[model samples]
Target: MTAAKTETFTSLAASVLDIEARSVSDLKRYLDANFTRACECLLACKGRVIVLGMGKSGHIGGKIAATLASTGTPAFFVHPGEASHGDLGMITSDDVVLAISNSGETGEVLSIAPLIKRRGAHLISMTGNPQSTLAELADVHICIAVEQEACPLGLAPTSSTTATLAMGDALAVALLHARGFTADDFAMSHPGGSLGRRLLLHIHDVMHKGERMPLVNADASLSDALLEMSRKGLGMTGIVDAQQRLVGVFTDGDLRRILDQRIDVHQAQIDRVMTRNPITISADVLAAEGLKLMEDRKINGLFAVDDAQKPVGALNMHDLLKAGVM
Candidate 1:
C-alpha cells in the first residue's frame, strides 16, 4: 500500500486500541457496592451462574462463563433466545443470572428477564445504561459504559464490549482469589492443555525405567557404560555402586571431553570419567520441575532417585520434548 494508506491504517488501529483501553480503565469507577454485591451473589450461589445475552453480548458472555467456570465459580452461558424455548429449565432458584446487554434493551434478553426472576434466581445485569429496564429490574447492576465506540460511526459495540469483557475478567479473578484457586486447581480444569502437563505430569510418568534405563556399576569400564548408553539410546548412563545406588553420571559430553584428554574408554573406570554428585530429582516431582532443574544446571539428562539415592529412572531433554513437557 501507499505510505499515506499505511499511515492511515496504523493510526486507525492505534485509535481503536486507545479507545478500548480507556473504556476498560473507566470501568474501575463503576466497581462500587453493586460490583461487590454481584460478587457476593455469585459466591453464595449454590448452583451455576447462568449467563444470558444476545449477539455480541452473548459472545462476550460465553467467554466470561468459561473463565468463571475454569477459575472457581461454576457457570455456563444460556442463549436468551433459547431460554424462551426450553433452555430456561436449566436455571434454578439457587443460581445467579448474569445478564449482559450493551443497550440494556435487547429484546431477547429482556424477554427472559422476568422468567429468570420468577424462578427466584438472583439477577445481575451488565449494561451501559444503569437506568435501562433490564438494569432497573436486576438485584445488582454493573455499568460497563464507554465514552464512544471505536467505530467511526459510533454504532458498533467495540469499546462497550471491551469494557464488558474486562469487567467480567475482574469478577472472575476476584472470585478466583476469594476461593483460593491455585495453579494445580487450574491445571485440573485444563488437563488437556500444556499448563496441565507442566503441573500434573511427574518425573516417573515420562522417565525411562526398567530395561529402558541406562545404568552400569561405578567400577565398570567406560566401554561398558558406553554400551549401556548406546543400547538405551539416551546418550547417557547412570553409574551405580554395589548396592545399586547412584554414584555418578556418564554422558556424551563427558565422552567428548575425555576423548580430548586421551582417556582410554576401554580401560578407564566409569566412576573416574563420570560426573559425580550430578543433580537428581525424585520420581514424584513434576516433569516441569525436572525441566527447570536441567535448564538451570545446564544439563540435558536427569536420573530419578529414591530415598536411598538409587536410580529409579532416567530421562534426557529429548524425552521431555517427546512427552510435550518442553
Candidate 2:
C-alpha cells in the first residue's frame, strides 16, 4: 500500500475503536429499571436462559450465553433459524428468553416470539430501537442503541454489536456479583483450564506421598540421607525424629556446600548438615500457593507436613512443573 493508503487505514481503525468505545460508554445511561428487572428475572428463573439471535447478533449471543453459564447462571444459545425448525422444543415454560437483534425486527426472531410467549416463557429483548416490535412484546427491553456504525458506509454491525456484547457482559457480571460467584465456583465450570488447575488443585493432589516421600532419621548418616534423596529422585530428604516429626531437611544445594568443606559423607550425621526448622506447607493448601512459596523462599523443593510437623509428602519444582502449577 502507498503512504497515503497506509495513513487512511490507520485513521479508519482509530475511528472504529473510538466509535465502539463511545457506544459501550453510552450504554451506562440505559442501565435503568429495565436492567434491574432483567437481572431479577434471570435470578428468579428456575430453568436456563435461552438466548436467541440471528447472523452477527447470534454470534454475540452465543458468547453471551457462555459467559453467563460460566459465571453462575445457567444459559445456552439457540439460533433463531434453528429454533423455527424444531429447536424451539428446547425451551420450556420456566425458561427466560434473551432475544437480540440490532434492528429489533429480525424476521426469524420475531417469527418465534409468539410461540415463546405461548409456552409461558419470559422474553427479554435487546435491541437498538426501543420502539420496535420486539421491544413492545418483551417483558423487559434492554436498549443497546449506538449513535452510528463503525463502518464508514453506516451499514455494518460494528458499533451495534460491540454495544450488545458489552450489555451482555454487564448483565453477566452483575449477576455474578449478586450471586456471590467465587473463583472456586468458576473453576468448577472450567475444570480443564489453567485457572481451574490454580484454583482447584491442592498440594495433596500432586505431592509424592507414602514410600515416595524422601525421608531419613535425624541420626542417619549423610550417606543414608543421600541414598534416600537419590532413591526418591526429589533431590532432597526430610530428617525426622524417633516420633516421625520432621526436624530438618537436607537438599542437593546443601550437599554442594558440604562437599566444598570436604565433609566425610560416610560418617557425618544428617543432623549436623541438615537445615533445621525449614519452611513447610500443609497438604490441604492449593498447589499455586506452594509455587508462590517456592518462588518467595528461593527453593525448589518443599515438604508437605502433618499437624505435628511430620513429613507426609515431598515435592520439587519439577513436580510442580509436571503438575501444571509452575
Candidate 3:
C-alpha cells in the first residue's frame, strides 16, 4: 500500500476508536433514574420485546434483538418500513416495542409509533435527540447521544451507531441479570453451536452402550481383550466379573507399561495388567463434566456405570471430540 493510503486508513481508524470510546464513557452519566425506569418497564412486560429501527440503527437493532433473545429476553427485530406494510400485525398488546433512531425522527419508525401505541403496547426509544418527535411519543426514552461523529464529514453514523448498540447491550444484560438467566438457558438457545454441544451433551448420548461397549471377562486372555478393544475401536477394554460388574480397565497405555516391564502379553491374563477400580462416570453426566474429570485426573477414557455398579457404557477423549464437546 502507498504511504498516503496507509495514513488515510490509520487516521480514520483512530478517529473511529476515539469517538466510540468517548460515546461509551459518556453513557455512565445517563445511567440515572431514566435508565432504571426503562429497565422497570421492560421487566413488567408480559410478552416479547419487539425491536424496530431504520438505516444504520436498524442494523444495530437486529443485533440487539439477537442478544436479547439469547440472554433470556424473548425479542425479534422488525423493519419499521415493513411493519407499516403488514408486519405490525406481529405486535400484540402484551409485547413491548423498542425503537431506535439517532435523530429520533426516522420516518419509517415514526409511521408505526401511533399504531403500536394504539395497540396498547409499551414504546421504548433509543435516540441521540431526546426532544425529537419519536422520543416525545415513546413511553420510555434512552439517550445514546455522542459528542461527534467519527466521520470527518460529521454526517455518517459512526460513533452514534456504536453508542446505540452498546446501550442495547446494556439493556439486554440488565434484563438478563434481573431474570437470573443462566448459562444453561443460553446453551438451550444455541444448541447448533459448539458451546451448546459442550454444555448440553451428556455422556449417555455419545458413549458406546450395551454390548457395543468394549468389554472382556476378568479371566479373559490378553488376546481376547485386545480383540474386544479392536472390535469396538475404543482403544480400551473393560474387565468385568461374573455378574458383569466392572473390575478393571485395560488400555493401550497399560499395554505400553506392561511391555516396558518385559511381561509376556501372549500368555498374561488381562486382569493382571488392567487398572483396578478405574475412574467412571454416570450415564446422566454432562459431556463437559466428563472432559473436566479426564483433564483433572489426567486420564483419557472412562466407563459409565449403572446404579448397581455394572459397566453399562464406555467413552474416550475421541468421543468427546467427535461430539464437539471438547
Give one digit per residue, the lDDT tens place, for model 1 in 53-99: 89999999999999999998999999999999999999999999999
The local distance difference test score of model 3 is: 0.92
- Per-residue lDDT of 184 in model 3: 94
The candidate that wins on TM-score is 1
Candidate 2 whole-model C-alpha lDDT, 0 to 1: 0.96
lDDT of the structure predicted as candidate 1: 0.93
Clashes of 1: 0
Q: TM-score for all predictions?
A: 0.98, 0.97, 0.95
The CA lDDT at 61 in model 1 is 99
Better of 1 and 3 by TM-score: 1
TM-score of 3: 0.95
Worst 10 residues of 1 by lDDT: 190-199
| lDDT of model 2 at position 264 | 98
Better of 2 and 3 by TM-score: 2
Candidate 2, residue 250: Cα displacement in angstroms equals 0.9
